[model samples]
Target chain A: MMDFINFYLVPGITLGAIYALGAVGVSMIFGILRFAHFAHGDLMTVGAYFGLSAVWLLGIPALAAIPIAVALTCLVALFADRAFYKPLRQLPTIYTVIASFGVALIFRSVVQLVWGTESQVYSVGFQKPIVLFDSLRIATRHIQIILATAAITLGLHWFLHHTQMGKTMRAVSDDPALASVAGLDPEKTIRWTWIIGAGLAAIAGVFVGLDTDVHTMMGWNLLLPMFAAALLGGIGKPLGAIAGGLIIGIAEEICTYPFFGESLISPSYKSAIAFVIMLLILIFRPRGLFKGRLL
Target chain B: MELSGILFYLISFLIMGGIYSVICLALNMQWGFGGLFNAGIAGFYAVGAYSAAIITSANTPNHVGGFDLPIVVGLVVAGTLSGIVGWAIARICVRLKADYLAMASIGIAEIIRLAVINEEWLTNGSLGVSRIPRPLEEFFTGRESEMVFFVFVWIIVAITFWVAHRLYKSPWGRVMRAIRDNEAAAESVGKDVQSFRTQSFVIGAIFMGVAGALSAHYFKFFSPDATEPLLITFLAWVMLIAGGSGNNKGAVAGALIIWAIWSMTEIITQQLPPDWATRSSYIRMLLIGLFLQFVLQRFRAGLFPEKAPKLNVKSHG
Candidate 1:
């Protein structure tokens, strides 16, 4: 039982932390933009590729590559906003959503064109397993993932609460027009939000790739889980997104171990677990678990 | 090239376009009329295709197959199953607003795909159930078979379009449009917004199912790979968006135009140098993406926008 718990629960929390990082980015963007940025997953993919490129080109260590990738991803986000999103700010919310789908497809196709359709593994060389309490073994990579996620989450919380720009971001999320009237530049705030969100997505993508090889489909597949977390936590609520991610991750892991010996649920269906959770939450409590304002 | 080959390609393109037209019309109904953003239409389409194929194909061990049900019955069952799934999704997600509904629908679609891929006992796993029978194998063979299949599908498409046209002008459609434009207003006006949306979604799924069944029979093969993102989901979106969003005629026209361009470009790419061919395919996808962005940017109303019928209110003196 302890062995099973260590294998399943520990790995689940690690995976959940990665998902939470992606979800926070998604939630933050949704909070600020008032539209679901479908291109977010592809953005994550782009970030992974960027990190891969940096690792390959500069011979940077895997740990060092992450921050570089994050910076580059932020730039990409800033550019994406300037190119694709800024023009559509005046359009209807639905239109922006649809346009984001277009942007997502473009990003996906571009990635495919550049990287080819083949999956590539970027080995960060962190394969050591740490012994925990003489009975449990945890991967060093997993520890990194959890620690990185916690640091980022705490940093984001602090930034949102204590900083001037963070307050402006919150104000914009609460009421864009009102925030604009109070001498806050909505466009700049939105640009910053995209940068921050996309930057975090890159971090998650790079770390996930470091833990488990880089693939073009990594970000696309992660999109649903991230959305599930964001919706589970409450749209636009960062804290909610993190908590939701952990819950989804743990639930998915637990579901893989079927109760009563009915046969283990396949890990492929782990995504379905998140979907089910999302559907139930949306049906019963559309405001999500945290009951934040609708995006 | 021989005239017969050219004719064959033309006829085949139209037939395939007919299938897409049916799918797009269903999407138009839900999205254009009812304001439901269903990103998972392909999942239902895949289900429809697989359901029909499994019912009619030869049975394999560890699963129910080789039932050899009639093609029409298979089609109906596919549509019904898709409708049921859609209804379930609607019950779970229809109450949510547009963005949330879209996300939920997409999640449901991914779940369906996952189930299909993982449930080896049911769907034969990724190997997929093959040897699906055509509707009229004995009467038609070779080119004749293709032509006959084309005509049969065109007939289905025509009927679907006519039914959709009649339904669009009906009171039900008006309520759907009202809900699409303003859910609160429609609800205040005594329409059960949820039920209406749910019913519309189910009906659309039925049409999508039928389209899938036609595709399966036409191809005579089924696979989990049939439900990939670009091929099934994004292609449908492109067709619907390129055509007029709300107009059936526009949807059909858009499918034909896009399918024709897609096929022609594919053919041309094959004739090019290997390096160029591979490069051009990516270019083509980029172009499509750009075109969608361009349309969204410039022609927000689409190629053929849905014009609201003017009410001739008599001058109040």
Candidate 2:
């Protein structure tokens, strides 16, 4: 039991936490922007690379480098919105979605151009897993991931509930027309939305980078799972995203268990599992588990 | 460049463009008339490529492929299988918002690509399935083979285009477009929007499958790489949109023009320093993205919007 918990459950939770961060951002964007924001995974890649840059340039500890990385990524997201998405705001929603694909390509290609195809680590050294219980061990990075995700998630929940800007963001998401009628500045709300969403995505990217290595394709690989979580949790509900992410992460890791028999189900099928679960959920419950808005 | 070299390049460009035009036309049918966004063309295309390869390729060691079926049979089987998959996918996903279809299709594509890679018995893993029998290979050799293939591709494209044009111009096509423009309105008028959506989706997918099979025959090789979303799916969307959705002529033209630009960019990138050259594809992708944004911002309707349907109204007292 301990071996199973250590091998699958712990790592799954860590992966879930990272996915939660991304899913929340996706949820928030869907809520406000009313599009899937397909460049989201690429934004995570940019954020991860930003964190890597901070570590390389300032030689700071990985954790210490995250704030600067998050800030820079937020700015980058804002720039992308202004440059690409803002112009097509008045067009059909599909236009924005297609435009998001283009942005995704641009961001990914830029990452490849700048970083090359080689993978990089934040602090290149192996630390032994810290024993939690009898034969149950957890990595230091995994622990950091859980704690950081918890902190950010909680922060987000508090902000959405308690703050004026957060309320405006929610209001815009709920109904832009009503929010504008209520004298809320939609532009300011959109700016805040981008900031928060991009900031969370940056943290998620950093965590994923820490857990594994920062590669150009890392975020692309995470794209389906993140969207799956977003859709599963309910598109606009951040809390739902958390649950969806954990569910997907656990399901993916669990699919590789020996119960399937060795070599019958390769670890490579983990992504397929995430998507399959998502498809089932979508098929049975189109509004998602949390009953978020149908749109 | 030598005349022969230029002619060869042009023929190759046309052949490639012809294959892509079929894909674009299918997309135009889906997005233009049906308002359904499919982000998994690459997946369906791969299914077509692999299934056709399996049926048509000669037997090989350590893999499955010995039937040596006729090319026409391979194309039909590929189309049928892909259409079935598309129908299944649409049945589940079409009930949701169009955006969800995009996500679902991407998932489907990824799953298909994954299957192609891991299911080595069929796709032959990384080695890929090769030696796909080309149509008219016996009589056509050398540059003549290229010419034959080019003409063959255009013939297929033209036939498909004509069929698509007829389908969309039909009353059934108008109903599909009506459902897209206003689902509730169409629903109130006793039209089954979901069924219509599925039919169009299936039809478009069949075209994509046929295109994939045609491409496999021409290239004589197919790997998991053939199904890259960026290369096949996204590029198809760009071509369709830029050429003008709802116009078959525009789709064909867009495919040709974009293929030309894309190939030209490749040629230009080859002259760069080795280090930079390695990253040129990424740069080209960035430019393509920028181009898409530019097109959307400046010309949202594309170069040619769908022609307004010519309604035949009789003056009846």
Candidate 3:
């Protein structure tokens, strides 16, 4: 039992952390923007590519490549905001959503055109496994993932709770017009939100690349899972996304172990697993697990 | 390259446009009237095409190929299957938030494609089913077969358009539009918003299914890859958005113009230098993407916006 638990549960948690990062970004963006940014998954893919490029160009350690990827991703997010999203601020949310889909398609095709529709592997140079106990072993890379996710989550918590910009962000998310009247530039706040959100997505993407292999369809494939996580956690809540991701990840992983004579659900269906959970949750409580508004 | 060639291409374009017009009209009913962003239309299209192909093609001795059913039966079955899938999706997804619904629908679409690709026993895996029988082959004979097929497809398109128009003007259409504009308000008036939207979605999907069957019969071949993102789903979105989201006439018009441009560009690009042509396809997609963004930004109302239907009642109180 412990062996089974360690093999499935621990890895699930780590994978969940990566999904949580992406989900938080999606949730925050949805909260503030009032439309789903469909291009976000592609943005994550862009970040992974940037990380891969950084590793190739600088010949730096994979650990060091992550921060560089994050910075580059943040820059791209800022640019995308200016070019694609900002102009559509006054339009209806539906139009913006469609626009985001266009942005995502453009981003995907560009990636495909550049990368040649092939899967890429980024060697992080960490091969050692840390044995946790008697029956279970974990990879050092997974440890890095867990630590990185924890640090980012804690850091975001601190930033949201203690910082002025964070407070303004919260205010903007809560009520944009009210925040605007209270001397916050809603545009600037939203831009910063995109930067932070996209930055987190980049970090998650790079980490996921390190954990597995990077592919052109990596982001596109993850879009549904991220959306599921975001929806599961309540659309606007960061903490909710984290918990939601963990639940989805662990549940899907554990589901791989079939009970009785039933066929085990394959890992390829991981995205579908997350979506099914999301559907059920939406049916029972459309507001989500945290009972928040449908941002 | 002669006058006859031009005429032939024009006729082909009209036929192709007629097929796409059916797709765009279906999408219009969903996105325009119902405000449902269905990114999974491609999946339904694939299902329809494959259903028709598998049904009409003669089954080989050593392989699963087709049932050799009648063409009309194949078309109906395709549409029915697609409608069933749409109904299932609507039952599951119509109650969710708009964005969540879109995500779910897209997921469903992806799942369908994956299943079709991976389910080797049923769909013959990636090799795809082919040799679908055409309707009216006996009457049309050899050279005139194409013309007869075009007429048959155009008749179906016309009937679909007529049904769509009638539905739009019906009381159910009013409820669908109201739901699209403001769901909360519609709910306040005691309407079963979910059911109405689901009906619209299912009906639209049936039309799309029929269109897919038509395409399969016309092409006489199909593969799982044929139902990929660009061809099935996004192209329909482009046609609908370009035409006018809320107007059937606009949707039909948009599909023709966009499809014509798309086909011509594809042909022209193919004739370019090999290296340049290969890269120009990417450019073509980029242009479409940019066009989508530009149109959405500049003219959300579309080339031919739907004029609000005149109301019969006026009150002074």
DockQ of candidate model 1? 0.72
lDDT of 2 at B131: 89
Candidate 1 vs candidate 2, TM-score winner: 2
**TM-score of candidate 3 on Cα atoms, chains taken together:** 0.92
Error of 1 at A151 (Å): 0.8
DockQ-best of 1 and 3: 1
Global CA lDDT computed for model 2: 0.88
True contacts kept of 1: 0.71
* Deviation of model 3 at B59, angstroms: 3.3
Which candidate, 2 or 3, has the higher TM-score? 2
TM-score of 2: 0.97
Worst 10 residues of 2 chain B by lDDT: B59-68
RMSD of each: 2.1, 1.5, 2.8
Specify the CAPRI tier of model 3.
medium
User: How much TM-score does chain B earn in each model?
Assistant: 0.94, 0.98, 0.95
Task: Provide the overall lDDT of each model, using Cα atoms, as 2-decimal numbers.
Answer: 0.83, 0.88, 0.83
Interface RMSD of each: 1.4, 1.0, 1.9
List residue ranges in candidate 1 displaced over 4 A.
Answer: A124-126, A181-183, A258-264, B60-62, B310-317
